[model samples]
Every structure is written in C-alpha cells, then in structure tokens.
Target: MRKPRRGAVILLIVCLFFLPSCEAIDNDFSIWDKLFNPVWDGDFSSLNYKATYPENNVTSGGNMEAWLDIVGWFNMSRINGTDYIYGDPANQSITEYNAIDTLGWNDNMDWIKHELLYDVVNDTLIVQDNITMLWHHSEEKTTSEGHTYIQKTYYYSYLTVYDSEIIPKQYVYDGQNIEALITFYNNSINPKSVIFIPDKLGLYSIDYTYKNESVHEDLMTGYVENNSKGIEFVNFTYNSGWSDPGGNLSHIGVCAVVKGGNFTPDNLSIDIYTPYEQLNITNYNLSTCNLFKGERSMHILLFPILLIIFSPFLLIYFIYKRAGR
Candidate 1:
C-alpha cells in the first residue's frame, strides 16, 4: 500500500476539524426534532375549566343565560365585524357597528361597546356590554272590553359574559330568553396523533391527520367549524396587530355557545386531544433562509464553509490525475 501524500494528510485533518462527526450529527438531529416536532407530553390538568353564565334579567320579561364546558383547548374569534373603537360608548363608530353586525343580532337592538376582562387568579374571563332595545306591541282589532286596545312594551338591556372560557363572548339582551344552558364537554378519549416528516423541507406538503373524524383540514389549514353540534376544531387566526400573549395557535379543540335558549347536549362527551404541535414556517425568513436572531446561523453557514475549504484539495487531485494520464 502506498503512503498518503502530506497534502492529503493535511486535507484530512482539515476535514476532521470542520466536518461533523457521526455523534454530532445524531445530537443535532435530536435537537432538530425537539425544536420542530415538539411532542405534547405534559400534564394537561390546567386545560379543564367550567364556564357558567347564570340566568338573569337585565329588563322585566327579558332574560339571558349561557354555559360552556372546556376540557382540553379553546380559541377566540377574530374581530372580523368591525374594529373596536375605544371611547365610543354607543358603538356608533363604523367599525364598532360593523363588528356588532357581524354577530347577526336583532337590528332593532342597539349594541353597546363591549370589553373583555380576565381574572388570572380564578382563571375566569368576563365580557361586559351595554345594550338597549325597544319592544312594541299593538292590538289591531277589537280588544277585551269591546274596544280597540294597544299595548307597548319597552326593554332596557345590559349584558355580561361572566366566568367564561371563550374570549369576546357575544351577548344580545334581546329578550329572546334561552330556556336551557348550552354545554360542551371534551373528554380525553384518543391518543394524540403525531406526524413524522423525513425531512424538514417536507413540512410544506405534509398533511396532518386528526383523530376527530369531523376534522377536514390539517393543523395549519386554519379552518373554523361552527355546526349544529356547536363549534369544534376551530382555529382562531388573529388579525394584524393583535397578539395572543398566551402563545396558543388557534383554538384547537371544542367549544359551545348558546345565545339565549336551552341547549341539550346530544353527545355530552367528545375525545378532546391536545393541540397539535407544528413548526411554524413564519418564524424563518424564507427569502434569506435565516432564522430569527441568528439562532440557526451556525447550521446555515456550516455546509458552505465546508465546501469552500475542500475545493482546493479537489482541484489539486484533478490536476495530479491529469498529469499522470
């Protein structure tokens, strides 16, 4: 066997210094999995919450009541109806009115400005509103005493979303009177599903399979489902400038809301799995392939540096072979 040249030995040493060892590669792959494929493996007891809005009358003959039970996850709707205008009491601002209009409440009713309050200690969410409505009734024909009679009724409404799980709950004080409380229960019934992509690049085309047979979209598809069964598998996407300090990606479970009447749960228990974990592509600046704050800069620079360092040795080997030929 011929001895290796001094230049070859030096190049080998350079490769050893720059290239990642097998152990290093394995360690790196594990880190990559942790960052991108974060497993949902922790106690989920914090997810259990019971929301109750007691029945009450803001005005005589007009009552409101609602309740929601959350077991695993929750999400709130984006303010799609109108921009919330602060200091606008009547909610007359075009944006504020539009927001109320989006809820599809009675047009005769006036929407007062709405606000949300959170109690950290109790883990309760409160929604307060000021609403007003005019109720009118008239008898067109003969009345009880052999004479035409007309009766007019007026209702003044005030609403609040007290001790709730969902955010920005809508209350109409429209006197519609809900007879039964709406209830939603998410019982842990199925194992959380995990998808493994062979490469990070494959994430763009990956499709997540949800255990809920009703789910039609992947975790990233951002679909909202509000059906007769109540809202489930809804993803809440916030508008620009809105930030969720809770660090949750869309409400990824089940929820139920009753406007003003009795709701009976046909299926009281559902298999509520933990929210799926995903690698957010927006965190990376795709144009530059640069991770935010240079977190992955070392990984990005490694391959290029290795290529540059080995080019001269490859060129030398080509030239020596040509000369020998």
Candidate 2:
C-alpha cells in the first residue's frame, strides 16, 4: 500500500478535530431544553384574570350573540346551586340557559363542567374546567360553505400562597403546563425514587428510580421503571377533574424546579399503549442546567465561533484535493 500524502494526513486530522467538535456542539449547549422544554419562571400568577364583560348591551338573537350574552350574564350573576341571578332582571336556572349556549357550543356541547380543589398542606388552590365551545367563522363570498367548528378545551389553573404572597396561575394551551405545577418541587424534593400509585379505576401508573446515589444538578441521573399493571402511560398532562387538580394524572413525566424560582424538565418519557398490550416508551431528555445557570446564550454563540475556526481548515482541504486531482 502506498503511504498517504501529507495533505491527506492533514485532512484526516482536521476531520478528527471537526467531527468531535460538531458532536460536542450539542453537548456544549442545552439545545433540547431550549427548544422543547423551555424554562418557565413559575410566575403563573400572571395568567389569572377576573372574568369580565363588555359595558355595551348585547343585542341580537343570533347564536353567537346569544351565547356570548348568556356567558356574560352568567359571569355577572351570582351562581346559586344550578341557578343564576343577575339583579332580579335576569333569573334563570343553568338548565334554562343551556339551550341558547348550545348555539355556539362545539360538538353540540351544552355544559361547562368545573372542578375545584384546595391543598391545605401545600397551600395551593386548583381549578379545572372542561368547556365546550363553538368556534365560528365568516362565510367567504367565493366559497359556498360556511365555517364553524366545535371543540372541547380543558383548562387547568392553580393558586398558592408562598412567602405570604398569592401566586395564582394557569397553564398555557400546551400539555406541559400541568406537569410543571405538580413537579414544581422535584429538585427540592430530590427523591431517590418516586412511585406514582394508580387511583382506583385509574388510567395509568408511573414510577421513577435513581441510579446514581450522588445527585448532580447538571446531569440526568435516573431511570424510569414503568411497572404499571394495566394503566398505560399517556402524555404528561393535568387532571381534568376540578375536585382533584393533581388527581386523575394522564401524562406521566419528570420535572425539575428551583425553589422560589422557575420550573423546567430535565427529561420527559411518554409511554403509549393499548388497553391490554405491551407498553411503548418514548423518552425525551432535555438539558436545562445551563439555562438556569445563565450559560445558554453563551453556548449558542459558540456554534458560530467553531465554524469560523474550522472554515480555513475546510477550505485548505478542498484546495488540496483540487490540486491532487
């Protein structure tokens, strides 16, 4: 075999250096967490807003208009055990208003189910509601069809008193919001093992065990031992029940949080399965330690710097190849 040329040897060395750096680029930055599991500052209180209505009188018999008026009236009125009262001028049972509400209701839904829970130990208040809504659209003059869609939206909200300050918050539309709240104290708890017991007649069960005895805030340090008998692990999401905000867990995943600060997931594993079959577990590992330590932006900037450093080497390799050819 002929000995390799000097240019070839240099090219090989450049590659050895370049490939590792490219791989290290990912490790150097917590790109997964930044993209998927973004760091939440745990300031959910901003989501809290008192229900309000327009000062102008609602005038119309259209379904959308009628439904809005009913909702506005319901908010303005006092709720009295299946009945609503708005200054004597309006007094109606929830059932009476359900008919008009259906006009704008999605999926032919006629009810709004609400659940509320209070945790004395944690000093937390949780409210969950399943509301069916009629999504409306205007008819296009060009198209022959009108547009309307019905949808059921689930909302999860929580309120807590920490350090004598009221912290009220709600989850964003994405599914991760509820999980953030439940595992808000994971880092602080720092449990060696977490066993999620399935509720009686429940849907799923989750268990987590840590391999390394020593805890490293920077590394993912555990394994998920899913020993569920019948319940299949779904997405990490909030319980829809109002009476138990943390109950009826659907999505099972892990989370990390800084006490009195923000919440971010280090890893999330989703298990998909049928009612009576083997489980399929999909894992998502998110690196967020750098984000918390304020190194994220610096790491992102390093990518361009690496390219700049290697650009000359890459150009030389191409030029040498052209001369040899």
RMSD of each predicted structure: 26.7, 27.3
- Which residues of candidate 2, in runs, are more than 4 Å off? 1-177, 181-301
Estimate, for each residue in 41-145, the C-alpha lDDT of model 1 and write its tens digit. Answer: 222222212323222322221333322222212332212221111122222111111112222223233333444333423423333333333333333567678
TM-score (C-alpha, index-matched) for candidate 2: 0.16
What's the CA error at residue 317 for candidate 2, in Å? 1.6
lDDT of 2 by residue, 78-102 (tens): 1111212222222210111121232
Best by TM-score: 1
User: What would the TM-score be for candidate 1 when compared with the true structure?
Assistant: 0.20
> What TM-score against the true fold does each predicted structure earn?
0.20, 0.16
Residue 295, candidate 2: C-alpha displacement in angstroms: 13
List clashing residue pairs in candidate 2: 44-169, 45-168, 106-133, 106-150, 115-242, 116-242, 235-251, 236-251
Candidate 1 deviant stretches above 4 angstroms: 1-122, 129-131, 137-163, 166-230, 234-325
